[model samples]
Target chain A: MDTWFYIADLAGVAVFAIAGTLLAFRKQMDGFGVIVLASVTAVGGGTTRDLILDVPVFWLHDATYFAVIAAAAGVTILWLRLKAYIPLNRLLLADALGIAFFTVLGTEKALNTGVSPVVAIILGTMTAVFGGMLRDVLARDIPMVLKSELYATTCIAGAIIYVALSSWSQTVAMLAAMTVTLVMRFGAIRYGWSLTVFKEHK
Target chain B: MDTWFYIADLAGVAVFAIAGTLLAFRKQMDGFGVIVLASVTAVGGGTTRDLILDVPVFWLHDATYFAVIAAAAGVTILWLRLKAYIPLNRLLLADALGIAFFTVLGTEKALNTGVSPVVAIILGTMTAVFGGMLRDVLARDIPMVLKSELYATTCIAGAIIYVALSSWSQTVAMLAAMTVTLVMRFGAIRYGWSLTVFKEHK
Candidate 1:
């Protein structure tokens, strides 16, 4: 189970790096900017979680995560000219998957850190969303989370499910939580679903 | 002294809002983007400081900060047409002053939160620099702090001086810290002084 979680983390890192490269490339950012985006996207979520927990940053403690992101950056650099050949939709799917995995990872980490359940839920949601927030801000897009959307809602739901199901096997809990997140998010994207809480003052 | 501090905070909020508007408006951001930038510039530093200290977010509890940023955003919306007459250099100076005050304020808050001195200094410097980081990332500029500039170093030096003299009267400590930060930053800008640590390895 631990091995599977580690693999999921590395996969998420790679996907996030790819997303960052795509954003930087779309913005015509230079090589340094590409690397910066990749690093920030890959490690940004974990770093926020660690800082909130007052722990040594996981990437700082373990060289492997940093190495993977750097290698991903190198790949983006080498493939820069051929980037147009890549499938944008596929990359978008990977980005969504990364967000889903991160929601679970962040929730579990917060629980382990002994943070209160409610704060843990908020932190989990933040952990899943903030990297993309940084990316959109850098890309000059209105941050996607602020729109009438179901982004953080998915993470929050997953966190709640995790807390409720922790009495089960850890693997079962993780699977159920992640399934809930992916289903909710993909459903929102597929059907043009949205939350319209803001009403006209008139 | 409390009144003066609040006045200074209001001044900082105004300067930061204009600066944020400049960056966002250059990208042709819509009203929502404008508001997000204004809110982030005004409250991001303190929110970050509270998160690091594991404190309830102050802005959420007190509506004053939120109101000030909102009012500043309204002013920015009206002033966008007059932007051509606005002096960018003067705005930059005002922005630097905002950063200086945030640094001291963050340091003092962290000390009160019972964090260690070293961590407090780092938090102080982050509070000083992160608004600009958000601004630049949203503006798609390579962050100013990543340059060889003395931006955060001013905050760092001032934080050390602040910690050294923190036992003195709070007003005296604040005045000394602000003086050091302002003078150091001004000298750096005037002489194009920069930290040696950022010299590239190539």
Candidate 2:
């Protein structure tokens, strides 16, 4: 189970790096900018989580995450140089899978830190969504979480489910939470679902 | 000296909160959004620094910074409701003053953590510029540090000065560093100075 989780975490980092690189390509960012954005997208959320929990940053201690992010981003740039076409739809599906995995992973990590359940849930959601938010912001776009769609909502739901089921079985809880997240995100994308934004009147 | 530093830190928080609220007003963010941005702008950099330094977050330990930020943002909102005109120029000056102070403070804090000089300089610059970066990101604008002028550069220069002079006298070191930062920032604003952005060509 530990090995599986480790693999999933690395896979999630690669997917996120790829997603961030694609976005940077759209912005026509320089190579350095693309790499920076990709690295932030891959690790920003987890770093923030570790910081808030007052722990040493995972990447700094392990270094594997850095290696994966750089490799993923480099491959992405090279692939894009060879082929101009971007399969954004497939990337979105991969992103959904990544976020689901991250949601459960983040919740479990926060729970281990002895924070309250609600704080853990929020931290879990942050772990899943904050990286993408940082990516969008650096690209000078409004964060998808703050603007439209159920991006954060999906993470929040999955985190809540994980917390509720944790006393039963950790593996079952993780599986169920990820399934719920993936289902909701896929449904939103397939059905063109969106949350209504607040209207401000002067 | 500790009392004076605490007061200065609190004042910096208020100034940063006001600066953030003013920027949020330009984006026409709601009250809640205004407060959120203001708070992030006030503490984002320091929080990042503390997290990296593996220290308890200053605000989490003290809470005074939070109170100052809330009060500052609330006052700015009220002032704007009564007066439609924004003193953006003056606000820039105040921001310069705030960043200068924060640069020295952050450098000192990082040094106290026993990090190397280079890391201290980076952390200090992050402490001064990161909050504004977060504010710009949340507002869906390009971060000023990344986009235009010598924002981060000023902070960096100030941090370097602070680190260099630390072996001399802390009080003199702070004043000299702050003066350098203020001069650079004020010059950049007054003379319309900017760094040449790297152009990417396909």
Candidate 3:
């Protein structure tokens, strides 16, 4: 079980790091900037969650996360010539999977720490969304979590579902929650679904 | 001593909240957006520091910080009518004071936790600058700490001074460090001191 969890975690890190590196590339950032963005996008959400939960920061204790981010970043830089061949949809799918995995993991961690259901759901959503938000902010773009599709909303809904089903088997609840989050996100990406924009009235 | 610290902390919160609210107003964000910006700008740095130190989030345990932020935001909203009369320099001064106070306070807290001096100084600088960085990011502006002025450098220098002088009386060290930070920041504001911008080569 622990091995599976670690594998999922590393996969998420790699996906987010690639996304961040691509963004930095798009923004014409230098090599150092690309690495910084990749590292932050890979670990920022979990770091925020751990801080809020008063736990040891995940990346600080485990060097594997950093190694994964560095490896992903290297792959991204080396694949610069193949950028035109890389499908956007595939990136989106990887991002959705990462969000789903992180949401369940964060919600379960919060629940284990004895926080209220509401806070757990919120933290879970934050944990799933904040990394992307940080990446966008660093890249000088508006955070997609704040404006695009049903990103954060999907995480929140999945977290609430996970909490509500806590009386059932933990593994079953986790799987169910991850499925819901991924489906919602993928649906949004496929269908161009989005939350309403709040334009200011003049 | 504790009372004085609380007083200074609240003052810093009020100043940063007001600055955040005014920025939100300029960005034409709604009331909820204004409050969110204000709250994050006031407490974001210290909250970040506490999280890194693995300590209980300060605002979670105490309601006063939120109350102070609310009051400051309210005042800023009401003072919008008198915007032209509000001197920008005074706001800068308040911001300078906030950086000084937070730098010393964060450094002391990190030292209390037995972190190495270098880590303490870095954490202290983070505590001093991250709130403003968050505020700018939320307002969709590049962070001042990253781009302009001697802001974060002042905090770093002050934190180093505090740590180096730790063998001396804590009170004297704190006061001296705060004074140095304030002087450097005020000098920057008055003389238009700034770090060199890193323009990307075409």
Pick the TM-score winner.
3
Off by over 4 Å in 1: A74-83, A200-202, B1-43, B50-202
Each candidate's DockQ: 0.08, 0.14, 0.12
Off by over 4 Å in 3: A28-35, A51-54, A70-80, A87-90, A187-199, B1-39, B51-54, B59-129, B142-202
lDDT of 3 by residue, B74-184 (tens): 877766744524466766776788889899888988898999999999999998899999988866888878776798999999999999896787788888999999988
Q: Across residues A90-165, which tens digit of lDDT does each residue of candidate 2 receive? A: 6688678778988998898899999999999999999888898888878877887777488899999999999999
Local distance difference test, candidate 2: 0.82
Give the per-residue lDDT of model 1 (tens digit) for B76-129: 666665443445565568677888888888888788888899998999888778
- TM-score per model for chain B alone? 0.88, 0.94, 0.90
Where does candidate 3 chain B have its weakest 10-residue lDDT segment? B79-88
- Give the winner by lDDT: 2 or 3: 2
* lDDT, candidates in the order shown: 0.73, 0.82, 0.80
Better model by lDDT, 1 or 2? Answer: 2
Off by over 4 Å in 2: A1-46, A52-54, A58-133, A142-202, B30-32, B200-202
DockQ leader? 2
Compose the digit string of candidate 3's lDDT tens values, residues A1-202. Answer: 6677678778888888988887777787876999999988889998888888888887887898988999998988888856635566766776788799899888887888887777687678778877987888878786666445578778987998899896687778878899899888887898876543223322
**Distance (Å) between predicted and true CA of A45, model 3?**
2.0
What's the best-to-worst order under DockQ?
2, 3, 1
In model 3, residue pairs whose N, Cα or C atoms come closer than 3 Å (at least 3 residues apart or on different chains), thus clashing, are none
Candidate 1: interface RMSD in Å? Answer: 8.0
